[model samples]
Target: MMYDCNLKIYQTLNVQSEFNIGLLLLYIIEGSSNISINGKTNMYKSNDMIVINDLDHYRILSSKKSVIACLFLSRVELDKFFRFNKKYYINKDKLDLSVLKFYMNKLIVNYVNDQSENEKQNKILEYINQLVMTLHLYRKLDGTIISNNIDVYSGINYMYEHYKEKLYIGKVATQCLLSVRRFSNKLEEVTGMRFNELLRNIRLSYSAFDLMYTKKLISQIANDNGFTNESGFITHFRDKYHITPAKFRKQLENDHYYPFHNKNTTLLRSFEHINDQIKYLTDRDVDYVSIDINMKNKIRSKISTPNLLIYIRDIETLTNNFQQSKLLSMRREIGLFGLLFSHQLFYELYQSNFENNKLVHQMFSFSLEHQFDISFEVKLGKNQNIEEFTLIFKRLLNYLTDCTYFYGQRSFQFYIDASYYQFNRISKIIQDNLKESKVILVLNKQNNYLAKRMSHKVNDNKQIACKVHHEIDSDKDITSILKNNPSLNILYQPNIPNRIESLISIFKWSIAFNQNISMIIDDTWLDSMIPSQSTHLMIKELQLNKESHYQLFELILTLKRLRGDIVYFNGLILMTHYLNEYQIIIFPNMKIFNRLHQRININGFKLGEIEYRHHDILIKNNQLIINSDGDTHQNMAEVSFKREIGKLIVQFYTSPYAIKHIYIKQKIN
Candidate 1:
């Protein structure tokens, strides 16, 4: 590491500066100044800061005087710590340079104190690393960072959507309207993978999903995903995953908590959601339940579910039954943590009922009965006028204040339902009020706000999350979302996928990338609570019904147990190592649904008591053997199983989602 002592200390007072060869960090010490960087002008007041990249031109103008400390560091050196991609830029509105300012101040003091060059170099390097981390840098594909080139992304997108078909660099280049050579260069720049390499990854990623989620044969999967032959596909799969396709599938199955295709019919039916099936599952494991309440629905009997999220479509239903619902009583007795209703209904209620109205007072009473958080789904319609919204917002504050008096300040959270543009308007209003409560700006699938860096400064209490009404199962889409909205949480609404396995894969992707997510499954998607006829048949056991729904719930409960550091995550496998346990979620990334034939081998785990399908699973001689026909096959490949290491391998069976839970009695000593 090298530091140019000549550029160590500088005081800028209404002067222009250019960073043609290195990065410059400008910190405002006193007074206020107008600064322009790369043609974007913003006011830099006391404690304000900005990082100007190399080759960027910036100018400062102060009316009286301003003390600005500028530290210029070689960008080439910074690249050793971070890629410093050209496309990465901190928007003026989105900049949170407080952390950077702290480091910059320390580095400046070191320079002023005349520290040793090596010491200064080490400190400066620490500062540079901190700056990059604070920015929440996105991951790079292969080695190349995400490119901003529309053509390059377009080319990638073209390849992604049609990777199943025969693809050539020329065909994709032509689709992106770029020459072969130009497209090849751009693709390499964006992915750090050549045309064939990138295409193979795309195919392999999809094929991997198929391998886990579908029952497609290796040859068919390879052929469908555009691989010329099974051997080539196996070679590529092994090259990327470091395992043969057969072995990879086997490992996923053996590690699963419960095999989806269990041979025993009696064991499968035991997990189905019958008459109190939801209650049974929730009693065992479930953090919260998202249930809808309508005007016709009466105050039903309450179950001992820990947390409740009451979804009220309109105010009429809320006013009609919310106060009377057993949920309110449950909140007081046990504790239902949260309630949700639409903002439209709230506005209508306020307009219909005067201030200090009886209904509003009663609503506040029920909410204040327990210290549960209230979330209002604030939806902004297309034709909604800002003036009208502002007026309603004023009334909302008054309404919130009345409740705040009872519920205490900052107890309410606003769930703003808005498009990308609408979010900007409502967020500004909320911020303008100086409200410290948590605000979640919820966006829809059509809104690409997640991909674009938000221009609004998200306060400490505020978090923005994208809420999609549909299922996002594509690996590419998940990767793109995680990369673009590194700070945003994800909320999936209405229904869990038809297949629990798909969701397991999605959850793995989120966990692997260290992203926060919420999945809400509405009652409607459960296909009615009516119990289906019990047949001693396997096919009948695995149909999509309430049983399967509850099974999904059980799977969610199991998934939540995976809490710790994500040691490794590729598209195919996710490894999470916690203090008490280490969990692995392995799924194939196929776009289609098919039945899989699997032979699994479990290794690296100490065999203890195993809980699978309510039967005692024994590991003999470090090998677990089970045939497809409810019989033990001792001839299978033997793997090491140690008693010192216990693992929970949850496997999803067809029709019913069976969870295999292995609890380690002792921690690693």
Candidate 2:
């Protein structure tokens, strides 16, 4: 209940994928990750404090000999904890050098050495007592005292704010109207470090984080963080850590796998993907849904209380296919859906049951559409407090969703048919946050009333969008449109052979210069429209990772859908990557137009409307040109680079993994 100064094992083994509430993990060391409180399976490394909240699954990725000080309990349980012990929780200010480390190590030792129930319970209680004290102190210090006396805390906040920049102590001292020596002495007395040394420490800490958290070049990190030179930063970093930055990172990775660091890493996140990391948490008879889309095989597998991936194109029966996985578990509730499981289609039982529960696998395939439902409850193996965990789980999901999509991080995209309604709602929210920021809207065709309404919100204080489409009559039309609807501007967009040209047209009219666009997908295919190359750029904009295949796929497919293609008729690129398990054909550009034809009219979808006839596409002189085979060249990387007929040509590039050796060598040393 009350966060004791100790650690407790909530669950000893792996568990189900469900969310939790009021769970926070404190990091003992520096870690890697851009944690958004919204999604599952985000990467996290050592020493990152994470707050777990709501979600469809739990967050339990890899846990090393990681000693984590977790605060978990219902509000009622926490009240009881506080009632029993008051001094256990600590304030951040009171968390000084020896005591924090001492308690941390104690929790680690206790959890490892003692398997006895009584010992575990005793230590858990002790840990909780100490933690409550720390939390209470943190609140009193952070919430009440700081707000009341802003001036006293302002200096500390200011230091933290600009610490990442190339901090000039001389300038800072001047601002405080003190002599160099006086400022130096005062700062050291206040924060316990010499000014320059403090600056160095801050820079080094940032550098260390950049090394672990980002894949940026060393030079880039040094330059961005205001280090004079990479070598200078390297020297200081080595002096501080007794190892090179590279070596330190190598050590971090090793420490995670082997016992090296004195601290442990805990990822505080929503409980959605927790099951993947944990091996023992089981499912309650509660109902839940598992959505699995496998592109390689173009299959959507289903399992009730099932956590397995299914690729629908498999020759084996769903039951036979998952037969092996069943042996790994003694208890499981499994079911199948789709055309692959047609034999069991007529069996109209509400739910099927197996005596000795083992593996769970389900499949279904419908020509037009395939739908199924599953419900299950993920339980924290340590205890059975469903209501409490659910609250945390839900909160965590909110954070994750923000991290996954809404953030300025290259997390979303702009599309031909992004909703004006969604855009307007998002605009209101953004306007509240950035009053002076500019907004842009690019419509494919619906550029009349909706664009006019959204444009009115834009002004000198907050610039509006430059609307564009192919229907305007001459330069006057573009000018007239913007004048009449001062809230918006108009640009020309022609349905032509050149997509790049069209995009260039849109970019040219953007008043924000580099204002990032958030493209909401078509109403019918929202999830399907979330993936694309444009989405990749959005991820870049948001500075988020492109590691999530599902996110990437979703983004790209959404782009395809916007392009009006048959999205799920066949397998997608990812489905192809997953291989013969799914069927994937059709170019993205073609897919869009065809889908539009299919949906908008009865006699649409005729041939000769697409760029790629086959799968191989061509890229020459930075322009996309079609080849005879549709996209036959899609899989072929530029084999070589050369000049042919005075044109800079792609004589060679690379096939997948072909240049991996060169890439790795360059990446390594």
Candidate 3:
């Protein structure tokens, strides 16, 4: 059998190939070859890395078809590897060979494995390293491969593994066996930034996840991720986002809305709110109605009539006393009931009833053909977080009554057992499970006192989520909310759509032409999130059934893949698994400017977002005019996920891209 100077030509390169004394230095340089380094005899594209030393025979074949780069270096070059491996061992498996993932992700040949020239350069290095290792000299050198550089390929691995915890500079220091000073210098050289800067970037990245995905509080976020106080958190958030935490949160609230079929307020409650239950599902052309809170429903009329009424039931009151009875009857009739005892001032009571009347009018009026308007404020003192309510709510109510002259108003219908916290808890249980969670609904029955008491504290926005605090809802109740709101479109894929084929197809094709795909993983932010995987797994046995669980597992795995993408957002996504496959371009979980989705080219050269010229990146108002300068399209996209407050983390897969666009708008003239 004949072999080329390059590690080339092997006819029997099957699953059981073994390495000879000096054959580890072989690299297939040109053409194509069937070289089985492992049990898989997969095709070797141009620049694929083959690292298998455990095979039975290192057969050499003269392939008119394949070219090889074999570096059977003279004994001296083999000596250099000994010196290079002094600080870190030059084992074929752990460091250079098995770190296939590291190389695949790197820009060199891993993610960019399509470049045969790069593959050639890497092959040359492999040969040289093998020579150095064979003579046992590369293992002896203390600081040879650029004295200051630590094996960064492994540092990233550490960050991926430990990013969720409070990682100290010292801990990373111990991993490298370098002094703090040495570590800092070397890290800067390898990572292109200082230690603190890298850490800040990590924090900022984590903040994005929190902003887009979790229900955690701002202050809690600070504490959970190792910050000492709220000020530190606000400062960090403001610095990165150019806005305060509250402001960021408000913006996020505008992005996601849950259609409320909420039983407490909707007046039309019976059914559960599902994606397919939107009103506009039947008619997409109609405008959505929102009852404006401004107009007051006056009881003024020349003719006598029963003007208003209220009803409160299912109560365990302090007493079935006459005073309680009197208050309940008046509030039930006059509409100002919640104001009298609510806070001593009754201002919020007036405000709430005013909005309630507006909603009532909208629901009853059919001639209202325009868009609706609405706003609401729910008091927190008596409902949720009772301790805080007791202190803060009591004080606020006193302030309302004392200075604001809200005292002595016989407006409220109060009950001893009424409280907001229990309302939310029971209501949420009922609303979420609909009919199937019967056991949960039954247990909730015992907590009716808390539910009724807390019910008034909730405000359903009517547009987004109809938050029924009901533990179980009938279809009719859910449908009523949809029937009332006739504008928004609704659709649902009730069962989890099988996304496996889509993912596998992407992987296979990503390797073929070497698609450019990138992934960025952010573990720290994922850790701080409350609803976690480990918890869900534990709860699955207690709460969920088999089919429901399979979908959950699929979702978790999908998230893990997404996390992997988030970690290395700025670089190449290396696919080093299964026989040194190939390279591709990719951008994982980057916050691209929502408007610029299609306007820019999202591959190659520089990584970032872009802005288009003359046309809105997204069809804001339609007229999309093509720019002639073509070159004016700016490069890159904006951050993918921006705000964390009030944002719901739903699952969806979007194609990641980078491109150029123009920034033509310059404020005012």
Candidate 4:
């Protein structure tokens, strides 16, 4: 029979039925029905769409005069479109039911009109495609159903029931009446994971559910879940979940946790929308050339002029000459102080034939004319050939040196790894060629090459910025790193950029110590590959709440609005007071999740009259209090002036990972 032949419309019905297999789509066009799929029952009314996947045991109880449209596709047919290797259940509630209803109506109309089989099948296929795209299918990690082989089915069921116990594949094979090798092959083929991996995943699923819904300690959860040790559990969890169990639990505690997907769904889906923003930011045609200089200037005028270097690690895109408009748009959207390229990429471009050289020259010329500082980071592997490396490095340096003559002695920054054998030689080259620019040596905590050792080698007239890697997990680590290295100017390389606590702590420390920090805008910041990650500032392209449109935009604006030096920073909170204005950022401490209900009090501010604006902060009776209840996304107040009287003490309670920005100013008398 034709594909469309499987769809049938019932005008009147009084029946209870079960469907053993195939994919089924039912739309209630006229009346309501009580439907139960796989033990759960719900009343589906008119305009409602329901999707039943393969092997679903569904029963339908309908009233007389009820109109229902049913479209069924067999397993053979569904396999042609989707991979049945893994079981998929549609997230019916998460989808836009209206869109599915519209397509369902179209299919029903086409079938009722006695349309040609070709046209009918095409419509059916169209509806199926929409269903697939709109309904983000939830894939279960608890092994695929093996209906054909009773032994395999029994084995899988046994595995599920005893997943918490220490399982050996040989014993499982014996229970299934099969050889060990046969069972292993069958399990891998059906579940896409090996014996140990599959068992661990099954345990993880239960542990994650408990983590989200229960208040059990990490060690207790790990022990109960059959993990050999808490550390092993954490390692496996991070590998699969992309974060520590504590942080994962902490993120769920946040009021902003949307629970947008299934419990089995990874936390990564919450921020998966960020991929769209990244795609938009990076979209470009390779053949497109740069716009005229006047056009570039006009584009800059249309938006807030951004001034921050964008770290681009993908060098091939640059060499391929991906549209300069995309780069310009990035600069327009997020201020690009300049473009930093990997030294290896520059070397490759330098060594390429004359045509590649022209491309490089064109890129540098455009960047220089646009007031973008071009910089490079040279990372040397211990096994690198020094002779070849230096040769290419010098050539790239020569090109930058030449650009300076044209761009009027522009300053250029070079970040050389401490591992480089000729660190001093490279520093000397930068010092002699670019007097105003800086050469920062990147060092880890264990590096024996202290600032003092390097300080004596360089001239006193030359300034060397000390940059150390910030890796340890506590405030004490930051204190020790700074106290021991007084000249440390930059927190060179920070890991786990997505963790809001880590980012906030780094920013707080930088502001407190009057030091500058940097971010490497690479995949770690842009990519959301796992479920256990927290939300960061993501740009929404469409019209959202215009008042709080682009969060990253607001963050950059806040950074620009700081009046003077940051006066107070205690990791969780930061304050900057200068002239007539004060800027303070308050956020909950993730370590002490219990203290979230408590209030924070700050005093000692002299003011004749107060003009204050705040975002997600409650200020009442000279205390900064939490909103008790607020929207998921934090809000931002437009810059305004107002009058207030009484003590300046501020007390506030905050939600997990919710960073609030408040601005207070004294009215000029």
Candidate 5:
């Protein structure tokens, strides 16, 4: 029986009653509408199309000024289409119909004009058939085929519900009222998997969920997921995922705690404790040199100077007021300064602010003589016009590139303050620029969506740096970002809690994510914390109280455990001064250590037996003396210590060059 195709145009708000007869296709050509299918709501914008199947109970809520073209295929027509092409069916509700808009418009025009000739009617039917076929072909091309048979649906539902049970194919076959052989063949035919394989896959998938979301024991997870034992589960998981379940969990934790820039880059979460401790040490004017056993040898010939990071608020004011001689003198006093400029300040200067330009040129000249890096901080919200901003930024970067080239230095970097909405729009531009030049793109406190997007675009050639401005709580979001982008250089803000537990949490998190982190300490905060002291007895007066000592020790230990770098802002001078006297060196984690051992094969460095303990650790003669926390010392070639010390002295161990390439390769895996 042939049934006519019905076409209706919705001009304004329109409601369609729930139906289970015909296959309905609603095309929004001019505007948008909201579609609800079984309580699940999705918005269909302009040039969007949605297909509602006979089985799907749906309602459409059209916009006030929407132009919707609705076409219905009667049950007879749907059945005839399915009989010939049983494997092809519309699976997705919403589809971007921009490509089909022309064809659909023609069909709508013909239907509205109502030319009732037989050929015209046949052409209308052909268009309807063509639309359905296109929808089917598109789904197949996109790998979105839906298993529509009732037996397959029921089997999948039963498997999902009973995946934890140790059930055999016979049991499922019995439940489905089929013989074991027939059931196996039917399952394979319907879902493209043998019954056992399907069951195992479901169990494995669920086990992964438990491993990531739950802190359950591996044995417990194995048992809960119907695996015979932990070893079996581990073997299966490793076979499928190429990483141990424990590593997966660690990765999840790391991604949760850090912001990922790319597969190889992650931003460490901010820790207030480290910052407070640094502030405390700087405030007390603690004599870090005096505590060092090698102070006389390291500091006797050199004046203690911290690394400097200078924040340039008004380059115009500085350049206008100061003489070049003064600028040169100021440059002579500082070492390794990082000059920061806000997006607005740079934009103004590039707009031909003469005084600012002069200041910039002078600064570059000073940097050429003194060796300092220029850091541009861009806040995305400030630029209302992203396209315009991109153009301006490109010009500024080109100018900076030229300036750096003239000065024979390449230390110009960008710190972008991005959010979800802005990053997506500018990601391509950023990626293109990254490929064309050598510049570090520092993303600060980006949302999950932007972070994920940026992470996917990262490659080995690009230098992507990520900084965490706040804590992240969503494990799923974090894990997704990290799983894709692992080679992230994480920068942690030192404003997080200072508790040992918190520090340990951060350490474990970093290791799990398999990324290196750096602590960004603000020099302004450090300087404000210090008290005025005369140069005469400064060393004697600069003493840490017991609490300050404990805080500093904890902070140092935390940094060491995480193998974290310390980036001193304006306080680089003070940091360098202290660093000269004492170094806080962290041993690599066990996984990293084994890799190092295999690659470096350094004398006295052994793998597998090394254990990290916290007790009395001493640094003397460029060697670490670790007091065993256990009663007897284990036969280990290397050991790490976590301890509270009165006179702590440290020396850093330079990592093997090969270790970096190995580390990056490991992360990629």
Candidate 6:
């Protein structure tokens, strides 16, 4: 058997091998270079030696003035010399040349020095034998060589080679001559993962490589890697790399941030970006601006002064409803009463009729289309069993999740009125599922006590916000009741109070404590009113006088300027004048907005010199246009109205700094 071992020096070499010429050994004595085997790239510095088997195609790009030593051995001759049938497998491409440096120098010296040909040949054989034994020992210690013992190492190697196939533990155990349970334990010990986990990881690794290199379709790659579907592949890829395969590939192509290359560093940079944005938005100097209470009180006193009524008489006629009893009788006569015949007939009929009415239907449809909040009511029968309660709660949750998927957006929050036990169960389910959806639970007197008690039992790490509703006179009583309940931060909702002092106190308390205050205005008309620090405002079955209605509009604008919290107006038909100033407004039904516009004076307000740029505005004679830009566009609103009405509403849904000034002109005709 004959093989070649030579010491060669090269200043620079850029070679792409078409075929591997036996086992090629490269020892770099000086300088550094990069080598690419197939598409995998690796760098080798000074004193590094690399062994490339005949099975691989490789390319070597040497740095300037680099020196390298090369040796080549035929597979047949190497097998004959080592007394082994199969070829040698180096665990890694690169190894430290230090161990072989001394022997290599000695061999060169012996060959160069004067000596008999047979003697030199004998020394060469001994040296080559020693090198093979050293590699074998190193391979064993590196855990990269498969042992000949057919039990453990061979079984693992087989799994690694055939992971894409449908593998069963029992079959593999039988092949390894071991019991199924023992094999399972041994597999876990060897891989540090269960059989299924290890198999999935192998497939995932291959898929990742293909994604980085191949131009194959994601579905085809998924199928090739034994994934049931593209979604499964995508889900697992996201879990491992924190991004989808397509996104990863795009990042690689664009030479942008690739998380997988240096995961911890990229993750830290991402967190830093988020932290910077948060700091910019919530800078203490900006968010915590101090407003003098004395000055606020003085301004409030001036604003709350009652003025002579400037009423729109037509609004009353437009919003007036037909006799309810007469409408019900007509429905019964026409045999159109299906659920109306039930015990809670009126409530059901009201909800159904309200939802089906053209204006109401339009409002609901528009809200859904624009991804605004849609409220659903769930009423529990008296004294229901736990199982029945849990089922209803679960159904409600499922509906919320379905809504999130259907809308293809997640800006909406769910509002539910539940008992203490029901809220407990719902909270547990939310925590277990790790849902990101927000839920606002409305509490009344009956369950408020139990909620406070359960607050103490909750985990401190858990986040919970409670809104408590109570009568105006019971402010001190409610405060005392909640004194011991430090675990829950309570927000108060007192029914609309008559005095301005009470309103100011409530608003100040809300701001001071970072809690919400709520008010329900039900038919009581006050002479003067101002905005409070209330998170929610529910007007229940109430119609205000024209002057009072105008005051409420002013209150809405003031609240918008103050906290910027979402205010929900339930069971109230807001006038067009009230709707003009808001960026986003939601109504219970479309009919309410329609009715408000029926006798609406286009001359209701003055028009401004409008500039229409982009797809931001549209005007149709008497109607107000509202639109959302599909799912990808968020926090945006586009509205326009004709100048014939002399009224113009300019609502900009962007950062405050981007707001444009409007030029108003009084109506001419």
Per-candidate TM-score against the hidden true structure: 0.43, 0.25, 0.20, 0.44, 0.33, 0.26
Q: What is the lDDT of residue 581 in candidate 2?
A: 22
What lDDT score is found at residue 49 in candidate 5? 68
List where candidate 6 sits over 4 angstroms from the true fold.
Answer: 1-364, 375-382, 389-400, 411-416, 428-434, 450-474, 481-502, 518-543, 563-669
| Best-performing candidate as measured by lDDT | 4
Better of 2 and 3 by TM-score: 2
Question: How would the candidate models be sorted by lDDT, starting from the highest?
Answer: 4, 1, 5, 6, 2, 3
Which ranges of candidate 2 are over 4 A from the true structure? 1-24, 27-145, 148-166, 173-190, 213-220, 256-669
For residue 198, model 1's alpha carbon misses the true position, in angstroms, by 21
| Clashing residue pairs found in predicted model 6 | 359-590, 359-591, 360-590, 360-591, 602-645
Model 2: what TM-score?
0.25
lDDT, residue 625, candidate 5: 21
lDDT tens readout by residue for model 5, 495-589: 43232233333334554565555444332322212322346534432442211323423343334322112221111011112321222223322
- Per-residue C-alpha lDDT of model 4 across residues 1-669, encoded as one tens digit per residue: 223234566544333444333467887766788889777999988768888765456767777545666766543344435444334444454444444554565555555444575676676666555454434334333344434665765676577668778889988899999999998887766555688886786677567666755789999999888898999999998877767788877765232222111232122212232334324322310111111111111111111111344565554334443344445555654554467776656556656763355666666777788787766777776677767777777666666777778888568777776553566677777677667777776664434345545545444333334443343433455455555554555533444333333444555565545555564444222222111122342233222222222333345445545555455544455566666776776664332121233223333445677767776522221123233243322222232332223335444445443456778777776
Considering TM-score, which of the candidate structures 1 and 2 is the better prediction for this target?
Answer: 1
Instruction: Name the runs in model 1 displaced over 4 angstroms.
Output: 1-310, 314-337, 347-351, 354-359, 419-421, 432-434, 445-451, 472-478, 495-502, 521-549, 567-575, 581-657, 667-669
lDDT of each: 0.52, 0.35, 0.32, 0.54, 0.47, 0.43
Rank the candidate models, highest TM-score first.
4, 1, 5, 6, 2, 3
Give the Cα error of residue 81 in candidate 5, in Å. Answer: 57
Candidate 4: where is the Cα deviation over 4 Å?
1-308, 315-336, 354-356, 456-481, 491-497, 511-514, 523-560, 590-606, 616-646, 649-653, 667-669
List the candidate 3 regions with Cα displacement exceeding 4 Å: 1-150, 252-669
* Residue-wise C-alpha lDDT for candidate 6, range 417-485, written one tens digit per residue: 566566556556654442654444544556556655555454533323344334353365455544544
The TM-score leader among the candidates is: 4
Score residue 341 of candidate 2 by CA lDDT.
17
lDDT of 3 by residue, 27-99 (tens): 4434555654323455664444554331113333333444333333211122232333223323343233212
Model 1, range 1-669, lDDT digits (tens) per residue? 333321232233555543233456667655677889757899878667767643345766765344556655443333333655443334434453544554555555444444676786676666556555554343222324223577776676577668888888899889889999998887666555799987887687667667755788999999988999999999998887777888777766233212111122111112122224223322321111111112122222211111234455444433556234544443344333366766656777657654657867666666566555677778777677877777877677767776666667565667877666777677677656637666787655555545465635555666776664444544455467667666666665544434465555556555545567665544233221222233453354345443355445445544554555554443433444444454544343222111112212233444345322222112121123433355544322222222323332333211011223333333433
